[model samples]
Target chain A: MALSLAQASDVVDAALLKARELGLRPLVITVLDPGGHPVVIKREDGAGILRPQISHAKAWGCLGTGSGGAAGARHATRDPAFFAALAAISEGRIASSRGGALIRDKEGNLIGSIGVSGDRPENDEAVAVAGVESADLVADVG
Target chain B: MALSLAQASDVVDAALLKARELGLRPLVITVLDPGGHPVVIKREDGAGILRPQISHAKAWGCLGTGSGGAAGARHATRDPAFFAALAAISEGRIASSRGGALIRDKEGNLIGSIGVSGDRPENDEAVAVAGVESADLVADVG
Candidate 1:
């Protein structure tokens, strides 16, 4: 089944709560459907001005590359020029970072993704994983 | 005060409710803060794949020109060249259409904007206005 709006909102809400509990900086969280369309986005009051855009790019990158944001970062590490060209082609919507995690169904099919921004890259990824798990979905962070 | 995330989501919720009440087609609704950053976006099931991007562009255009989408359309009509240049300069982020409306606070200061897509432009504008008003904000649609 496609990711429901209610599920997306739940993921974002859970992620934000996790961020607060961890004492991370204010965050921006975004959830995209399998087709790379945004379903929900939440920007905390004190988040950096660019956090929303960054979180969106991270999730878009996950959808575009069929990989988690951490995997994208690894790919970029090995091929900076190619990643840069990809970013240019996507109009800067792809971010090779660690805050994006792919969402999958029980059958192991890609469904959507969650992206979080505000803290260190690893911390962001951890929060995204927590959010995805909270929704009882698989997080394809690898 | 700036547009809060709660307020933005409320706008999207109200807009979608209106769309349903009007028997309009599935829609994509987007809200952008005054700085042109996305605060909330919701794409209904069956909405066209491009609706989110189109809605985002509409709202961004409204913020960029400090005018509602209808006014942007009028400006485009009067000076197509200038509008075209603007689209090019903004890397296709601006769309001069009739589905975007500026949001203002009680004091009449610009707060953000809402954009709706997936129907006739005028109908989209009507729905957006309904949403902004539902949130107790001004809808600058003139």
Candidate 2:
């Protein structure tokens, strides 16, 4: 099943609200569809001007690397040439760094991805995961 | 001096290479000039295609906000109303999110920005810094 834009936006809103309730300060949130395309993004107030881009980057990284955003770095470290080739083949679309996660179903099918930025990497992960969980989607995070 | 497309490509290449070496996966790397315009971008093979756009969005976000990149998100949080207005005025040019940073000179002059996507917020920051360091440019990460 594909994720609708409304659903994606709702997920982002839920995640941001959760972050605020937890006093996590402003955040950069993004949601991607099953193909890793951004559906919508929202930057919290005081989150900074760079937050939106950062959030999109993280989400894109997760979708590109096919793993949680933060884990992309670890994947790259395990294989350099392969990573380079991957980057090359993707036409500079794949990244393995941080602040992102793969969205999945309970059956383990890759559904989509979500990424958060503008705060601690761990915190970013938390907010993203919260959105996924709230959406009743399984978040494959490490 | 404006950064050439080749220079932007080099910045992204170096950043991705370093990120791979660091064992991080899921990163999106982007390079921009002093005007916060995209010069080059590489998304990695497995990285989602959306990463490239996210990188661009982050750089534009910084330029629109006049807060460089790092501090933009924080500013967004403190002044949501103003930020919203700015975002509206910029027509989605300003982001004020995470995963973006301002490129600086040794003298702390803002040269441009480097935005990283597909990773956790902090991890993205690290990779962006690596890209700038690879180019031997100064960076104000805020």
Candidate 3:
């Protein structure tokens, strides 16, 4: 089954709650369905205007690379030019960052992705993982 | 107040329901916040692959012009050159079509917009209007 809108909202809400509990800064979160289309997006009141764009890019990168954002960053490092070109082609919707994680169903089927932006890359990543787990879904951070 | 994720999902669901009731073909719908940022997007099974892109473009056009998609099309008709340049500048994220409608709050404040694709332009706009009203929001289709 595809990732439902309700599930996507839950993921964003759980991610925001985790960020608040951790005392992280305002954040923007985006969840994309398996088809790489946004299912839900939330930008906290104080989040930077660019946060939404960055969060979406991270999630799109995860979907495109078939891996989490961190892994996409590593892949970019090995071929920066290619990735850079890809970003241009995609209108900057591909990010090589550490704040995106793959979402999977109980059977380990890739369903979608969650992307967070605001705090340090590691903190963003941590919150994204927490958010995924809170929804009883698998987070493939690897 | 900003459009919440719940509201966005509700709009999508309502739109899909209306499409079903009308016996229209598969559709893709997109909702964008006031800032022209995506809130949610849904593509029904069997929709064309390009439906999402078209839906987003229609919503973005409405947001950019501060008018519904039908109005934007009229504007384009008056100045095709300008609209074409705008499409190029936006990297195809703006469409001059009739499948988009402005979303407003009870006080008539511009909140966001919804765009639907799949059926004829008029049919798409009709379903979008039904969906927005179903969510207890105003639809500016003129």
Candidate 4:
């Protein structure tokens, strides 16, 4: 099943609420369907300008690696050069880092990913987790 | 929705007026929304052929930094490696230094950014700021 625009908007809106609840900085959030196309992308007031692209890369990286950004982070640690080359191969789509999580249906089928940026890495991750869960989808922060 | 086309066009026109008033070189200007998509772009007659790309890069850089071009310039001067890597991450959409400003609403919500080229960095930035202000928007050069 594909992620709907309405669902994606809800995820982003919920993420913004969570970020506000946590007193974190304003954020940029993006949802990508399994096909690696963006379902929705939004930036909050005062969020960094590069946040949209950065968030896209984070979520896309999750899809490409088939794990929430965790797998990519591991690859970055285990083989720095190889991980560095990943960006070039992906044409700058992969940014192996935190703040990204996989979304899955009740049956555990991959839905896509939620990405948040504009704060500490862990804070960004927390917001993404909140977003995915808010949509009643499983969040694989892994 | 992103910044409206009419507003973007107004920004461009005002920037052009400012450039002429200051006796600056024929310039090119560009506006980009949060999604890093162009809203408007215009080049004055006799402007350098590269002005379009250069101005777009400057405005895009402002968005990438989550600030006006000034912060990016500071980053470039203080940390060339990090800035270079950032440029790579943004796929050359960023050109740090000047000629760009963040546009915000009265509530300080970032609407987009404007960029000007074909003059000295400060002069170009002034033109950009003037353009943003003409729309009754805040021009954040920081």
Candidate 5:
């Protein structure tokens, strides 16, 4: 795992802290390694039952497309057929939204990504960015 | 919804602490609410690629059988066909192993469960017991 658990934990912690500051709804946050496997996941007590899967899907989109969820949303709009096919291929594990971003190191290397759910898309994206920056890494929100 | 993220986080922390003390292989620990939904999951950096799913499966067995994973193993041994059918029914999400236990409050009420993967089943179960106790809960290993 190129992305250590400590780093992934930090990302999730920062994201949760940001969510608290913004007074957003409870969230489920997931951090995925570059290989698209989950490293850490934390769901707030009141998060919807499905938020965990949604969180994973948001990040899965970024991993599969080499683009952030925002970019995924754009692609979905520009190529709806392709994006729909992707959803079917991944068995509904990819989604287009604003709550996901690729984590990049100082050297511009992809390490992982963070995905958040349970708030407005923009707020979710904001929290994800906070997480990456808190770890001293760049967030490629695409 | 009876399990809070704090409790689940503590379970993962204590399990990891136990794993470190034993010098065991890296592990993936999963805490699932009684409803069989994941509340927290942590995969160590060097844990096997399939550990997350295995951890979840171990916990799922506990939730589905209304008994600990050890009981599931016993049932598997006593009635292989029944257990095999169970595995097929859940789409391979239920497993018989020693690393899963139902978590109960001091009053013997069910709360959630903790599952661990990476080391031998006994070692994994030991770490899970440590985690449940650390959270001031009892381990119902069945």
Candidate 6:
């Protein structure tokens, strides 16, 4: 399903709210389209300066591979060589790590992805998940 | 006091090395000229797919503003009016934040910049500083 810009923005806002509710420090969050282009982004005050770039890169990784965090996990796992090449080719707009997640619509169609940075990997993932669920989208955890 | 390509490459090498030494996993490191043009880059295997883009954008922010991390820190300060315009004007490429450092010669000449991502912001910034020092250049921290 085609992802609306509104949905993307909502997802990001929800994620930011959840982060605040949890008393987590600020974060940089980004949502990318299916083609790996940025759709929306938010940066919390007191978050690091590099967060927006990092978050966009992570979301790009998810969109580029269409596989979400699994792709980042693999880069951290079995495929170091290929991952490096991918980084070079993409010109540094992608990051495969624990901070990214895929966004899908209610019909189980891929919509886009959300990426978060400025925290622990697991915490980043949690914020993204919370953000998606808050937007009322089915964030496929599996 | 232009940074020679060799020096820039060395900066990238040292940044990547430091990232590994810190057990921060693989990273994508990039060095750019004062013009925000890339001079050299090195991506560690398994660094994630979008690292290169993030690195480039981070470097671009430094080059564009010529202030290293000042732009990033400004946004993180959360003056919403300024950040909103920044985000709009940057076309999603301007990311003013930590993890980037302006490269200057001993005489305080603006030469280039160093940027790192794919790890924590603190780790990323540390590696970037190491890179600038490795090239015998001053980091624009002040």
The number of the candidate with the highest DockQ is: 5
Question: Per-residue lDDT tens digits of candidate 1, residues A20-91?
Answer: 899998889989888887888888776888998899999989999898888899999999999989989999
DockQ ranking of the models: 5, 1, 3, 4, 2, 6
Give per-residue CA lDDT, model 5, range A49-129, as digits (tens). 899999999988898889988888888899999877988999998988889999989998999988899999999999999
How many clashes show up per model?
A: 0, 72, 0, 2, 0, 17
Real contacts recovered, all predictions: 0.63, 0.22, 0.29, 0.33, 0.85, 0.05
lDDT of 5 at B89: 97
> Candidate 3 residues B70-135, lDDT tens each?
888888899999998999999898999899988998999988889899999999999999999999
lDDT of each: 0.89, 0.70, 0.86, 0.83, 0.90, 0.74
Per-residue lDDT of B99 in model 1: 98
Interface RMSD of each: 1.4, 12.6, 3.8, 3.5, 0.6, 10.5
After the best TM-score superposition of candidate 6, give how far the Cα of residue A24 lies from its true spot, in angstroms: 32
Candidate 1 Cα outliers beyond 4 Å, as residue runs: A74-91
Better of 2 and 3 by DockQ: 3
Q: Which candidate, 4 or 5, would have the higher DockQ against the true structure? A: 5
DockQ of each: 0.57, 0.10, 0.27, 0.23, 0.90, 0.04
When only chain A is evaluated, what TM-score does every model earn? 0.96, 0.80, 0.95, 0.95, 0.97, 0.90
Reference A-B contact fraction recovered by candidate 5: 0.85
Give lDDT tens digits, candidate 2, residues B58-117: 676665554555687677667766765665566545555566777776777777888777
lDDT of each residue in B65-99, candidate 4, tens digit only: 57778877876786553354356568878888888
lDDT (Cα, tens digit) per residue for candidate 5, span B44-97: 988988999999999888989899988888888999999889989999989888
Specify the poorest-scoring 10-residue window by lDDT in model 3 chain B: B38-47
lDDT of 4 by residue, A61-140 (tens): 88988888766666666776676677778887877678988899889999789877888678999899988888898889
Top candidate (TM-score) = 5
Candidate 6, A23-60: lDDT as tens digits: 88789999877667778888999999888998987777
Each candidate's TM vs. the true structure? 0.89, 0.51, 0.77, 0.64, 0.98, 0.54
Any residue pairs clashing in model 4, and if so which? Answer: A49-B63, A49-B66
